[model samples]
Target: MSHAPTGARRREIWLLVATFLVAVAGLIYELIAATLSSYLLGDSVRQFSLVIGVFLSAMGVGAYLSRFVGEALRGFIWAQILLGILGGFLAPVVFYAYAWTGAVELPLFGLLIAVGILSGMEIPLIARVLKEIGAPEFRFENVLSVDYVGALAASVAFPLLIVPQLGLMSASLVFGALNLAVAGLSLWLFRSDATRSQWGVWALALLLTGAGLVQSERLVTVAEAALYEDDIILSETTPYQQITVTRFRDRVRLFLDHSIQFDSFDEYRYHEMLVHPAMSHASRRADVLILGGGDGMAAREVLRWADVAQVTLVDLDPRVTGLFQSHDDLAALNDNALRDPRVRVLNQDAWQFVEHANTQFDVVIVDLPDPKNLALSKLYSRAFYSLLMERLSPRGVMVTQAGSPFYARQAFWSVVQTVAAARNPVQVGAGPWTLPYHTYVPSFGDWGFVMAAPFAPKTGDLAVPPGLQYLTPAIWQQSHVFGADTGPIEADVNRLQSHALVGYYLDGWAKWFE
Candidate 1:
């Protein structure tokens, strides 16, 4: 039989609840700091690693400092109030710092340490509070076990619920409010032990966090204005990525995860360079397949060909495909290519689509972003190339947008080498199995492309489609001749297991930024 609840037992239960809520709040702050840093700066691996390292070390500092507190209950309550204020305002402060000043790493690591130290104080103080209320019934082990469970729960909810629903700024404020509530509950439970000073701090924390929750959207807008040069017309955070479109007069720019996808002014040159070479080289223009041109610019170029019958475009993000399909301003840029009856859009991962596609295509265009991270690096691997080669018809030709050869020479060469290695055998009327070509775009300088076919066409065999803004027949032939700085040299093939392109890409680009 269960006994009726006593005041002591109920106070202990409330203490345990406070422990869980504090743990969740602490972890959410850490994640928000790490994610925001990664978004603003490239190289997610470096940002997360450094942020976690600084955070954990500062936590150790907080733990050591906790030994000095004489009044355990008062110390714990005050720590909660301080942590609530710090973690609540962290995202907005960091974003404002980034916008006004170029120094992000300094403030980013500083806040990580501050929050980590305060959060570190929390678990130890809560453990002490539990002991003060009830001696042997609530052991140190029980408090620690509850703390760990809360952390695990927070980690799961961060990506699945918190980030998807509240986003980075608002999520921080909500969790901050929760932290302040824990402090309030602790003061109420231990009213006999609390002083007026502690109550005052809790009230101040409550007011600040309330203001943060209300002003989060305004803060996001101001930060965005500083980050982007053009006026931002549309911005949305999808489950997959951050999609932002900015407009500067007549020119429109699309940014995905803060990386530039295309600028409308010069996109014709990039798209024409991507689509025309393969379409002209292919024996048949019918049944064309595009791997990652979700923007519909590549499809727009492909449709210009008179002989083309059906165009299948596969892209991972439905948000991107849907926007390009519907939005009038964006649709006008792609010439309403996605809505065209001849084109079929499949919102799926390119890697999975290639693996599952049984049909063959006469022309294939790969217009994916640069492989700066692991997820994108996989798209450039030899395994992906092998899968892509499987879908090419006997007389088919393929083209892929290799990044700037001048800036990322080794990475550019790696793409060219990987495509050739994937198609190593089966020589069919060859002058060269793979041809590397590049054209200058005003937006992105010295961009490269690799045109591969089962049978190599002659030097002047490829023809540019009519009604093109860039790439005439003569200009197409001239694009193959790259200057000394931009021309390729020897590089290792990018394999799935090794992921050589990611390293090469980082090494090549990091120097430019420095």
Candidate 2:
């Protein structure tokens, strides 16, 4: 009849706090699982297939097992114990298993299922625990609200707090320890549910697994290193995406989504072909818009003209832009192009930037990576070209890094055809000079760009700029020559699944590797 004492009221608040903690642990498990999958498998398709497959399979099993759980909170306690043990070890185990067995897809799928199934039991079990502890008036909606709020907190912290500070390996253990804390809370609150001996063994298991995972950071790094053949010089994971640089002897390669963007070793071969032909014809007037060469090497070339008033570059990655802006070694490579007061670096995606530009340029250099997949394919699409064409001044030329004429013939022409389809009647050309270094994984070869404009592009000798070590007229001249073996093949530029071009890219790489 009377209100409960203050001590009794405090106990209910603690139970609600316990509910929040367990919900957070479950979400942390999902995030780490999904993130690792995305890293190991490139974004386009591998991650979705693996993560979704595992979660759905595990959900089915969780639903199946839920029917068998006993009346006591003991089942829920045991579930957290199992979840903590599995999820704690999940990151390091998945990484090492993939490296050892070479069946990345297998464990990648398996662990996701395990985490998902365990996570599914959490809500029902926690609700059951609250009810058994004499909190029957706690409405379903109230408990659900607590669960959902806890999820929101976990979502915010996992990326900003967990990943950046703790990193993937340590973060997994930290979350595992958090899950153990929830289990420990249940043990203290409900000693009557399980025997003392059983609780002791479960606690030992949880402690051993959590402590064991503390050393997991070393294994994850070693496993990742084993995945790549080259020496990984730098790897950064931004909230947006992954940026990796790998070096093999003389070659320093930049990779985004496991697709090679440029080899510092052979970038000149690609950049010279991309710039010189248009640079000479377009240089006389001096207006330039470069889309997506965040490395600044292209800016190094575009800024050479004394007549050029301004060079505006649009790249999506701020870190890349900032690196060249401040990092001394990189600045030297790009001739400090980002610092050139004449050059303006706009940190934005090329697609959105090109679509919305109000002004036109004497030259629009579309320096985006190849459209090996749909995300990049959009940049090469007819719609994107139309926007680009809209922003080109008369006599203004825009060049794209067309797949490859040698192997990705269809893909190379699809760029040509799409530009043609893009209402610009674009003229296409090929240079096979960069074919020697095609084993960069997921992509192949330094290639060509379709030169699209309102009129035929003027062909002339390359004018070597001062302060340059790589570009010359002779290299420019030879860039146009395609040999008999690696010359044009029947292909079309990629359009969604008409990935006739991706096939060509893959084929070119296969031959180059062979």
| Candidate that scores best on lDDT | 1
Measured over all alpha carbons after superposition, the RMSD of each candidate to the real structure, in angstroms, is 2.7, 4.9
Candidate 2 clashes between residue pairs 3 or more apart in a chain or in different chains: 410-491, 410-492, 410-493, 414-493
- For model 1, residues 1-514, the per-residue Cα lDDT tens digits are 7797777777788888888888888888888888887787766776788788888899999998888888778888888888788888888788788888867787778778888988888778878877776745667888888888999999999988988788787888898889889889888978988889889988988988898788888878888899899999988776667888999999899998778899998999999989988888888989999988889999999999989999999998898999999998899999999999999999898999998998989898999988887778888887887677778887788889999898899999999999887843345333227899998998888889998877766555657767888888777878889888877788999987888888889888887964
Reference-based TM-score, model 1? 0.92
lDDT of 2 at 307: 79
- TM-score for every candidate vs. truth? 0.92, 0.82
Once fitted onto the true fold, the runs of candidate 1 whose alpha carbons sit more than 4 angstroms away are 1-4, 423-432
What's the C-alpha lDDT at position 118 in model 2?
Answer: 74
TM-score of 2: 0.82
Tens digits of lDDT, candidate 2, 53-94: 667578668757766788637776777777777787787777
C-alpha root-mean-square deviation, candidate 2: 4.9
